[model samples]
Target: MKIAFLYDAVYPYEKGGAQKRIWELARRLADDHDVHLYGMHYWDGPAVIEREGVTLHGVCEPRELYVDGRRSIPQAIAFALRVLPPLLREDFDVVDCQEFPYFPCFSGKLHELVRGSTLVITWYEVWDDYWYEYLGRKGLFGKAVERATLRLADTIVPISEYIAADLRELGRTAGLEVVENGVDFERLQEIPAADADWDVIYVGRLSEHKNVDLLLEAIATATTQLDRDLSCGIIGDGPEREQLEADAADLGVEDQVEFLGFVEADADVIGNIKATSVFVLPSIREGFPNTILEANACGVPSIVVDHAENGSTAVVEDGVTGFITEVSSEAIADRIVDCLTDDDLLADLSAGAKAFGRDHDWNVIVDELEEVYSSVVQRER
Candidate 1:
């Protein structure tokens, strides 16, 4: 099947969880089907770039509304408008839409107009007034658009069960299924054991949404309570770096925490993660964090908060695979200490984590996706 993946961002151009999922799925599905990713490019860059046997079409948009400190959405939309006509004419069987708000709000009509084409909107993270918190009053547009898109979609596949519940609350009585993104089984399993270099490690964006301050607070508590001998490694970059730096100092763990900005997706990340004993994600929201998946693949356990959205809580079996905590710094610190000190427990958790990750193999996920596609296609015909 010729699949047109409609999304906001993708790999190499962007490094978020949503994009990573598209990159991996397109590549994996490429083994049998022809997959193409279509996104609006805000920056004045190349129209086309290819990787991993998949073609990436970037519609150049004006650099306004600089989202995530990168490409502009306005230009990407205009570009999508111009480029889409030609591309959509090229005989794709189905459109796999990512980001609910965009498909319905930004590009709903396009899908609706495409007769006989199955529109599968993959809901990664739907905000519960989360965007309005940042984007202000006009964020109502996003919510309305998302609702419209959800209604128009032939199938709504939320990455987590919590998201499915949200769809029900919104009163969109559509066929909502919990079809999560999968992981790279071979690359992750191929990782060789490495020595523990950092006492603690975090590999995600340093942003407000991720709650970087709380992580620093917990680290400070761990440093003093466990003694200030251990080091903390911060991987990935974001806007909240300075605030977090201050928080680290205020907590008196400044010297112990080191922020390593934007590491490449290579063996070094795998090795660094393998060298760490504990993985952490202090986020207010997430669809299904690929970092946790990657960490689990490395046989490392995580310390994530107990938010009931998007499998953030479901990822960890709490004391089985990794520790799941309430949104508290002291609570997070205590879990870290427990995981660090107990060799038998960490070993046991690692065993459970690896097994759980195996269940999320792309082979299984793609089969489910194929089922969604088949169902959509049958209904469309």
Candidate 2:
């Protein structure tokens, strides 16, 4: 099969959920199929190159798509203007486009229809009310555009049931499918464990929707109540860094927290996770976090907030693999303290988390993706 992936950023150069998902699938599928990626050239290398068995076409250079740490809709419009023409001429058995930076989806859908190729829109999550949380009044318009894109695809592939439900609400249940996110167990198993240097760690983008302020407050409260300085390692960079740092200072937890901005090396990132007593992500919204799965693979348990609108709660077994607490600093702080002080509970959760990680290995996920691609192609005929 000839597969084409339309996403404007490549892995490592601009790492995020969509980039990781597309790159992983492309590289692995290239083993038995002709896989090609079309995206903006964020790297300073050749416009066309092959890596990990897949071919990549750097269509255009990335523009300033970020405004105040969030993706600006205007930038997406610019990307679509540049990406559409180059992508229209290409023909493939199937073409999958990331649902974010949504303007390109309209053109990609038209291309697929005109070429008689199977079109699949890969959605990690639906913004829903998060539009208001992130974009204020403009979010309403964003939500409308998002729904329009969701309806344009011949097939919709959401990463979680929670996202699939959102699509259903948008009247897109006919050909919707759920393909869960996964972690690389083979690489994770090779990561050597390190001594616990930090009591807690949080990795990924430090953005508004991530609710990192709540995490800082919880860390401060945990440190004060425990009568001991609780060390925390925060990995990743974003527009929220300065605000988060200010938050830690205001809460008198600056000395207790280490803001390690964006660990670029995978080994270093794995080392930080393994060296922590517990991992936590107080994100107010998520589809299916690969960070949780990665930590689970490292035999590390995590604590996540039970977001009302998203399916982050579905990822954990509540009191087994990880604690799913209410979205509050006090609740999160209590769970963190329990995990740190109670060695028996931590050990049990660690075992459960590791067991869960085995079920969502990358190999298993790739096999499922292959099946989905084949089915979609067959149905297109």
Candidate 3:
């Protein structure tokens, strides 16, 4: 089957959970199918190139994905306009478009209508009420766009039950398939642990939704509670880095926290995760966090906050693979202390985490996605 994926940012070039998901699925599916990805050109030289058996089309020149720590509307609109022409020229069995930055889904829909291909919209999150928080009064526009996008595709794949539930509440019932995010278990197993170790680590973009500031506060509290030095490594760069660094200094945990900004290699990221005793994802909002599974695959337990919007809690087996605490610095601190001081508990959680990772391997996820594509194409035929 020939498959096409649409998103503004490409993987490895622009690091994010959704980008990684598309890259992993596209590359693996390319082994047996004709897979193509259309996105902003983060690479130089040519608009089209082949990498790892998948064809990548640079739909437009790369634009700043974020402006003032939020997704740039202009950038999304630019990609949406540029992507339509290329999409209209090609025909594929499945064209899967990421749901966020909603404009491009219309392009995929247009292509589906023109080429008679099955269009699939993969939803990471359904920002209904949250749209208000994200955009204030203007969020009504965002909400309307989201609702309209839901009806564009016959097949809508939500990455978690949390997202699926939201989609249902928003009047989407038919063709809603819950396909969870996954980890690269085999690749993680091969990478050796980094030489340096940390008491705790957080790997992801430092954005407002991520709540890295809360992690800084927790690290400070954990240091005070532990008495001895407690080191926390923050791996990943984003808009909030400077503010987060300042927050760490204000909390007097600057020495205790190290910001290792965005390690390029997947092996290095996994290696660092392996070296950590505990992985912390304090984000209050998440569709499906790929970092949790990645850490679990590295035999490191994760600590996630129990927030209604945080769908990552689904993958975590509370008290077994990891602990889920309320969305508070104090609560997170307590979990950090528990994982760091209690050697027996950490070992048990680590074992449980590895098992959890194995269960959600990317290979299994890809097989499920392949079935969805095939079923959609068959039904369309």
lDDT (CA) per prediction: 0.73, 0.85, 0.91
Task: Please name the candidate that would achieve the greatest TM-score relative to the true structure.
Answer: 3
TM accuracy, model 1: 0.90
Residues 1-381 of candidate 2: C-alpha lDDT, one tens digit per residue: 999898877887877767877887788889999999888887677988888888888877787768877787776787777777767777888888889988878768887878878888888877776788767998898888887887787788888887888778867878887788888887899987655598999998988878989999999889877889999999999988999999999999899899999888877888889999899989978888888888998888989998777477778889999999999999999999999889999999999999999998878888988898999998777
Which of candidates 1 and 2 reaches a greater TM-score? 2
Root-mean-square deviation per candidate: 2.8, 1.6, 1.1
Model 1: CA > 4 A from native: 40-52, 61-76, 100-112, 192-196, 308-310
- Looking at model 3, residue 123 earns an lDDT score of 96
lDDT of 1: 0.73
TM-score of each: 0.90, 0.96, 0.98
User: Which of 1 and 2 is the better model by lDDT?
Assistant: 2
Task: Give per-residue CA lDDT, model 3, range 40-87, as digits (tens).
Answer: 998988999999999999998999998988999999999999999888
Q: Which pairs of residues collide in model 3?
A: none
Backbone clashes for every candidate come to 4, 1, 0
| Model 2, TM vs. native | 0.96
- Pairs that clash in candidate 1: 42-72, 61-75, 61-76, 62-75
What candidate 3 gets wrong by more than 4 Å, as runs, is none
